[model samples]
Target: MQLQAYTFADTTEIKDLVTRTFSDSEGVDEGKLIGNLAFELLTETPEKDVFCFIAKENNAIIGCIIFSRLIFVRDIQVFILAPVAIATEFQRQGIGQKLIRFGLQTLKLNGIELALTYGDPNYYCKVGFQPISEQHIPAPLKLTYPHGWLAQSLTNNPIPKINEKPKCVRALAKPEYW
Candidate 1:
């Protein structure tokens, strides 16, 4: 298996991977929603605000992850991880976790200070994510599952408290996604 940054040529495969994975795991509607979300995040978001990574096996995309900038009133550098997916057949093989680790490491190397994600805490915890309250760092939108709000400091320092609410990229600004 190989993990690397995604290129424009990988767009269709990435969207299909996410759509099919979510369809098999969640359902058809959810698959379409997240698949469309992934497509927009990859194609519409500004290059400086988006990062995409993929895991491939035998030259086929098997897993993918995306991180987009979260702008705050303050100057701190932060990004949000969302819409991660692993091919149905590849689930439970640690490919998702490996991709996440690689993505986070890449962010850290680029001097990103914090990483946030909203998802299953149990699964995210495996990758060093911890529950964080809006009081410490307010989310761009009201969270549907507050318990799933997670964050980690890439610099090894504690997650800092920021009173200002952050705004996510246009691709992730939909309240339905929160």
Candidate 2:
């Protein structure tokens, strides 16, 4: 399988992938949120921090992963990996895993650190993510999970110790809260 950056032509296929992934995990209607976020990443006004990658087999999209730039402390820049999706029939084929590993390697090669994500630690850990608490950094989500909400450093530097409450680091939230 060839992993490459997503193209405009991949829009519908990627949306379908997200819809299926979400439906399998959550429910049907709630699954649409992934597509909505994908739309925001592809078509919305904010363009600086969003990027996506797709896996192709025989020129057909089989999986996708997205990275959105986020802020932790005042000026710190980090990337958030979200909405990783593989076609239902293609699940457990290692396509999604490869997409994440390749995407992270690409981001690290570009000089990024502190990739954050809300996903199962088991899967993300296989790709190098450690629980946020085990590292010096902390999630800005102020949320908890049973092995969800993880972070990984791209470099050898220690992640900043975050004792202060985490504020939402991405997306719109209460102005004073995040």
CA deviation > 4 Å runs, candidate 1: none
Judged by TM-score, which candidate is best?
A: 1
lDDT of 1 by residue, 98-155 (tens): 9999999999999999999999999999999999998988999999999999999999
For each predicted model, how many residue pairs clash, with residues at least 3 apart or on different chains?
0, 0
lDDT of 2 by residue, 1-178 (tens): 8999887778788887788777887788767877666655665525567668998888888888988776554556578887788877888878778899999988888778768787788898898887766245555555446357678788787665654434432442323211
Q: What pairs collide in candidate 1? A: none
lDDT of 2 at 85: 83
Alpha carbon deviation, residue 69, candidate 2 (Å): 1.0
Question: What does the lDDT come to for candidate 1?
Answer: 0.95
Q: Candidate 2 overall Cα lDDT vs. reference?
A: 0.72
lDDT (C-alpha) at residue 16 in model 2:
78
State in Å the error of residue 130, model 1.
0.2
